[model samples]
Target: MSFYKKDNSDYLEQAFYSLQGQTLPADEIILIQDGQVGADLENIVKKWSQRLPIRLFVNRENIGLGMSLKKGLELCSYEFVARMDSDDICHPERFEHQYNFLKSHPEIAVVGSWIAEFSETIEKISNYRKLPSDSEELFFFAKKRCPLNHPTVMYRKSDINKVGSYFNFRFQQDYHLWGRLLNSGFRIANIPKSLVYMRVDERLFNRRGGIRYFQIETQVQKTFLDIGFINKLEFIRNYIIRGCIRLIPNSLRKNFYETFLR
Candidate 1:
């Protein structure tokens, strides 16, 4: 699944190229237009539709990522759905590796992989986002941070729907959905190796701070608490630590992620 909101001609093209390069190609690509987009983006999609089985869905109004993804999930024809970002590049063997894992581990409902984050180019990888590989470790990790890389995940459609699907949250949609899945007794795991290259720049770091983001973080934490995924003490501790992390400089924030969260 992929979603786009504006004119991202260059990045979108690279994303599609990565998909086309995959050794185990996708059966169908579900592209969601979250809102009004440029003609250039439409043309790019049209150009790729000729080569791949691309199913496009347009949302007249901007409904945000959660609702947009929920719409995409409803249109998926396969049992397994792989999530992809409009700006990231997946490894050539990403699908093959993930598909084999899920097929062998029938009990696992979701599988994700580590990602190498870069600034301008894939060769200049800045850092890696490493995650736990087992459900027990993932459940413990989820109380404090997101246990899975959202864009690198391949999940069972039936399991996600059984756990109430994606919710319409501003900044924490993936995080919230993972919590719900864990509570519903679905197992989650991650591959130790990197399966995708994630794009990160100044804008990505800058988005982590500010009062508005804090409010959204607090709201998400409350939801987790109410759902019994987190207790009162854990919620308060998370809020304080995360609020402090947000208040720091972007450089320090990046370091915090690498030093503590990763």
Candidate 2:
């Protein structure tokens, strides 16, 4: 599944190329246009539709990522669905590795991999986002940070549905969903290797630190507390730590994230 909202023809083309070029290529690609997009983006999708098994869903109005993914999940025909972002590029062996892991480990409900963060090109990776590989560690990690890289995850559709599909959240939706799944007794893990190239630039850093983003972050933490996934102490600690990080300047925040968080 993938979602896009604007003119991203180059990224969309590369994403499709990477997907179709995968060693264990995706059986189907569900591309959701969250709202009306540019003609270039539409043309690119139209071109790929003819070459790939892509099912396009165009929302008349912007519905945000969570709703877009929720709708995409309903149309998936397979048991396991891999999530991707419009601008990210998956490794050639990403699907093969993830599928084999899931096939071998039936107990796991969701599996994600580390991602290499880059600005312009994959070769110029500026940072790496690593994650815990076990359920226990992931559970603890999720209390403070997002345990799974959302765009690099391959999750079981039945398990996601059982825990309740994606919520209508503006930010940290993946983190919130993972918390729900964990509370519902689903296991999550991550591959140790980086399987995707994640695009991260100054804009991403700025977006993550603003007041609007902090509001959504606090809301998600409160929901986790209310659901019994996190205790009062954990909630307070998370708020303090995350709030402080978000209050810092963007340059400092980026450095802190690259040096400490990741």
For all predicted structures, in order, the TM-scores are 0.96, 0.97
Query: Over all chains combined, what TM-score does candidate 2 have?
Result: 0.97
158-209, model 2: which lDDT tens digit per residue?
Answer: 9999988999778788998999999888899999999999888888889889
**Residue pairs in steric clash, candidate 2?**
none
Q: Largest TM-score belongs to which candidate? A: 2
Off by over 4 Å in 2: none
Residue pairs with colliding backbones in model 1 are none
For model 1, the stretches where C-alpha displacement exceeds 4 angstroms are none
lDDT of 1 by residue, 49-159 (tens): 998889999998889889989999989999999999898899999999999999999999999999999988999998999988988999989999989999999999999
